[model samples]
Target: MEDNIKDSKQLISEIQSQYTRLSKGQKLIAQYILNNYDKVAFMTACKLGETVGVSESTVVRFANTLGYSGYPKLQSALQELIKNKLTTVQRVEMSDDFSDENVILNKVLRSDMDNIRDTLDGIDNEAFQDAVSKILKAKKIHILGVRTSFVVAQYLGFYLGIILDNVHVVRMDMGDAFEQIVRVGEDDVVIAFSFPRYSKKAYQLVKYAKEKGASIISITDSLFAPIASVADNTLLVNNSMASFVDSLVPAMSVANALAVSVGMKEKDDIKDYFDDLERMWEKYGVYE
Candidate 1:
């Protein structure tokens, strides 16, 4: 009974710890979540009830039975669990649930739309603005992302570089990538991009930057993400894994929004920069 709601523990462990206390209906819900947590994480309380052939009230009560304030909190915990822990097998299996069902088109697109909506609705404006302000004032900004996340880092750093004076995109291709960031110090900022099955190397790099006293801005899918754990500012963009392929729609959308926000702040500078570049392009006859 004591220390009942420790969300830090794995969802399965939490459920198992309380298994003896659950009623038959609650146990059914618990078993469903345990077996298919990847699927359950995205379901609404009402939908979850239907999946278990129980009433909506029962699902809510099951959450309480598991020591969550409500279904959303429990759902969030489940989501946090899978984002960084899902194995490749689990991912493909979960993805198969959709294509195998034969409603790939509608279900996949609808799920993407939901992820986009949730990302926008869930973001904190204050955190967004703080990230922008840090980028503007930092003596140098280092953007770190790898694997699937590298593209997002490249997109943000590319656009931000157009407006800002010193934006560096850190890539693993440098081989000695961390060496490129050795000069990170108090006046610097490092924005790290991490998502589902987050890169341990990326997290370690952020931790390194944090140790060097550079302010960290984490762009990730969950507050539980390793980068988020040490970040000075965290921007959450929901990316629910609807298929074997991780959805990048929300992450890309977030990157664009961030670029636009920073662009607005540096509008005059950006204009002048572009103006000069246009002259150079014309001088070279670069256009067809």
Candidate 2:
């Protein structure tokens, strides 16, 4: 499954290279995808066939020709590619079945459920464990994400700050994100969240940290993501789109898991730390 997902990075080139060998109907399907991928990514096989004036079987054959198991696999590859490329307007216009509010709600929720399931199935356990181990031993830990991903990074940083004293969430608002992590060194661990429409600045930060000898752990959508290449351990999580906005539920789950795992490893100290925190919060009436 991982290999198939990774092949999506080269899917477009593969289609173009095999264009001449495609049948008349397959050629039509191929042309439609090549030209209108953003729209086609969200389309059903039957709908795609109707748009291309080909039988649904032709669409399946086209996918098979391209080495995918079937139409859904082909569509998944297209979705993966367009996640970063599609504009907000394009994303809104891609869905043809949002006529009913109830249907939209159900569809979006189901998509998020699927994203969580797929993420759990595909996430590398060894990499996840390695990330936890690195964080526990680090002299300092840097957390980074920008744009949409910043929410996940912030969630991670907040909880991790509670667990460990040396955690920093790189703040873009403070100044340059680079300056925030300027002190990262060999004993530090940098955990970054980078999803589709990936932040170039995040990549640059991770690369710079790696050069400075920090261990990098990248939590991203694909193995082919820019940060993945530079990461000491890459944790792949599915953040599939059901709307214009990228869903971060799966990423948040991973962040929660990381924080919990780290806390568990230092259970004795964390218990004492939180007890003091609880007393302080109660004295100040921090919560009702």
Predicted structure with the largest TM-score when compared to the true one: 2
Q: Write the per-residue lDDT of candidate 1 for residues 1-288, one digit (tens) a residue.
A: 222223735668878888888888888898898899877876889988998999999999988877778888887777766667778786776564565566888888897999899888889899999998998889999998989899889989898888887989997887787898989998999999998788989988999999999999999987778899999999998887776677788888988888899899889988899999999999999996
Clashes of 2: 0
Could you tell me every candidate's TM-score relative to the true structure? Answer: 0.83, 0.93
Instruction: Give per-residue lDDT, candidate 1, residue 73.
Output: 82
List, residue by residue over 1-288, the lDDT tens digit for candidate 2.
233776678888988999999998988888888898877888999999999898888888888888888888888888888788877887778665876787998998898899999999999999999999999999999999998899999999999998899999998788888888889999999999998887799999999999999999999999888999999999999988888778899999999999999999988988899899899999999999
Off by over 4 Å in 2: 1-3
RMSD in Å for all candidates: 3.7, 1.9
| Cα error, candidate 2, residue 23 (Å) | 3.3
Error of 1 at 14 (Å): 4.7
Measured with C-alpha atoms, the lDDT of residue 255 in candidate 1 is: 83
List where candidate 1 sits over 4 angstroms from the true fold. Answer: 1-10, 17-21, 35-76, 100-102
What is residue 121's positional error in candidate 1, in angstroms?
2.0
